[model samples]
Target: MASDMLLQHLDYLLALAAERHFGRAAARCHVSQPTLSVAIRRLEKDLGIVIVQRGHRFEGFTEEGRRVVTWAQRIIAERDDMLADLERMRGRLTVTARLGAIPTAVPASPFISGEFLRRNPAASVRIEALSSREIARQLADFEIDAGLTYLDDEAPPGTRSVVLYREQYVLVAPAANHLMNAPEVAWSDAAGLELCVLMTTMRNRRILDANMAAEGVQYRPVVEAASVDALYAHLSHSGRATIASTAWLPQLGVPAGFAARPMVQHGPRPVIGLVVPDRAPASIVAAALAEVADDVDLEAHIAAAWDAAGDRRG
Candidate 1:
């Protein structure tokens, strides 16, 4: 069979692996069930291997068949990338930028997406708030095109990255709360307030815990939530404060009667940035977004916002 024809059969095999059923895989590929089955058999014959386990229905692939599917994903991905590159050169690459970001880093999504859309008017980005570990998992599974996350020890290995900014955790509380307005607030001091904080399972929370623990302080929050948004809701309704990264301030702003105060420097800043797969991106739109990330001065934008609102103690 011609190379393109063989690749099409591989596509059918991949679809079967994903759907795990013959009829459904055929429907997904928009081909008849028999057509898909024949293609798989042809693929097996061309390679002289039993790529699929025969059964009354779709079962599974042999070991070598799994390897073929893996390489097929790569092969199809690179082919699509090349075609997208050609389209981009002609200014017609329309794509959706599926992106994931840790809740702390969600504020930076616009800085990345704004420039990306401006450069490619035909593109769009959707940002989902997720934990750092979830972001890495999604990237590995090709569930998202790119991610904004802590680039320190938390970043997954075998990924390519460009650091955007060093995150500074700050105290967000009611402006009328005189207990926290100072040049800076120490962790121990912040720990004594009515508090709502992220759950310990989150990377940001772990870092916060490690920092305060080093000072012989342990944060026991009045409310512990799993996500930044949850913590924000608690702070808003319960009239409490949260120790969140500076990234939160520029995006959500403090709720009414609130301000953001710098925390005392406790350790190295958590560098946050854009990360993508080490291999060719599964989507050309992702490649474009990563390229945009490399050039955008998100650090400057974030710093300017932070400086403008430094200790908003009014």
Candidate 2:
């Protein structure tokens, strides 16, 4: 009974760490602030350490609190894994998996999700578009179950990655635009065009910037957005163009009056993949996701898109 109570207290601490506000944390835990406060105080007393640095408002956690938070996350994750393993052993696996992905990888997610659902009909899934760095952070925090992002990017320590596909680049432009008739456009040529691109903070944008720089192309985006949808919306309304993964076009369809063409002379195609924490006895959902990922022929989808882009260009 005491052990179970301690687990509940750890839940409160995790909520506080995530929300950074006592009121919000209590709300998340569905308990009164005072209840959460007392539980935390009790936990601190039992642990013999000052966890939170409290004041008139919720101050940050002490160093000990941060360490405790890490332990709490590990313990909670292990608890979940144990439950999942039991369910799997009973041949009744139920799970709600969260997946974080980069904007460019969003198109491929539906296929992956569909496959996962087919395999685990009892499972539910949520996919969020996040930058690579954000995905790495969320994975470390155990806020997300897995991530689909570039494999070469800096990931948190103890991250296990499996390559999915090499992203193929395409230029998305208005159909009437002169560049659309070309079978392929060089990065330097595309750079001269008025562009609508993702914000610099996103890894996709950084990759584009680096590619353009390598090609000695001087470029400035006319519009900058944080989401792929926003960039597409801008492209639809304006004559400006943007670089996007070839996989995006099939899922989103080239907007009416828009054309997608393969980008030639583009530098290396970055390998994107599924990443998860490298923990022993991985969570059931994570293990299933990885198994499904292995069977996903991402390159085949990209190849089909390549053909579609060529057809659109012609």
Candidate 3:
């Protein structure tokens, strides 16, 4: 019986239910009132039930009509689901991806991901926080679709990467700390001072250690923190200096007594890059995301953020 009815006309019934009036319903359906009414009547006849109870004005639907409305909703939902499934099966799949990055790398994502979505509306994206090593491992394992991390001199094998930004360590200390008065502080200049830093497990911490060792400087933190928040909290009140990426300073919200200054080191700047494993061809979504990353304004974005922070400090 259902096979005999025009499936295209089910829209008219939905429109009628929404408008509850013949003129508006037909107008919404983009058909003449008589055309829509005739279609609904035809549907009722095919189903062998009274779908709508007519009156001087428009009255409500009969019990069977209400049931038909419920059925229409289920049918529409199922139809859309099937269409999405079919698209995936046909290699036009809509992919959902998770990406992780260090706190500093977070800003680059919106610009890149925004343009990606504009180009590929069918793709879905998610962003999360992860350390450089974690980013590398996740990409290698295919657990995350992509990652942004410091691209050490040795690039990971079986992966492709595009250098996104370079990072230099900086000193963030309370203004009361004498080092702030200097235009630039050398790694050795921090030797005698108390320090707070993320634990040794983080790549950032390792870089800090290398810089200190290169300068033959040694210091210990009176307090330890796992995250940027804790690092800054200790920085704000501990009267000690913390070393971190200059990229992270903008979001740290340094209090009145704190200021960040770049470190003077002869070592190479750490290059942060967007990485994807090269083992397989990128899906349409991942390809679109990679294209977006290629077009990002890394220098300008970082310069602007730093400039804005400088303005706030002034």
Query: Which number leads on lDDT?
Result: 2
Task: Give one digit per residue, the lDDT tens place, for model 1 in 1-314.
Answer: 55668879978887898899999999999999999988988888888888888788767888988888878777766666777788888988766778898877876688888898898887677889888898898777555778888898779777888888888888888887775558688888888888887777778888888878877987678998867778888876556898877776667776777887788887688888889888744467667878998898877777777787854744
**What tens-digit string does per-residue lDDT give for candidate 2 at 190-307?**
9987898889888889889888888888798999988888888887667788898877766776777778887875557888999988888787778888888999898888778667
The Cα local distance difference test for each model comes to 0.80, 0.85, 0.71
Query: Would you give me the overall lDDT of model 2?
Result: 0.85
Models 1 onward score TM values of 0.79, 0.95, 0.63
Candidate 3: which stretches are off by over 4 Å? 1-94, 103-124, 311-314
For this target, which candidate reaches the highest TM-score against the unseen true structure? 2
Overall local distance difference test of candidate 3: 0.71
Root-mean-square deviation of Cα positions for candidate 2 versus the true structure, in angstroms: 1.7
Worst 10 residues of 3 by lDDT: 279-288
Report residue 215 deviation for candidate 1 (angstroms). 1.5
lDDT of 1 at 62: 89
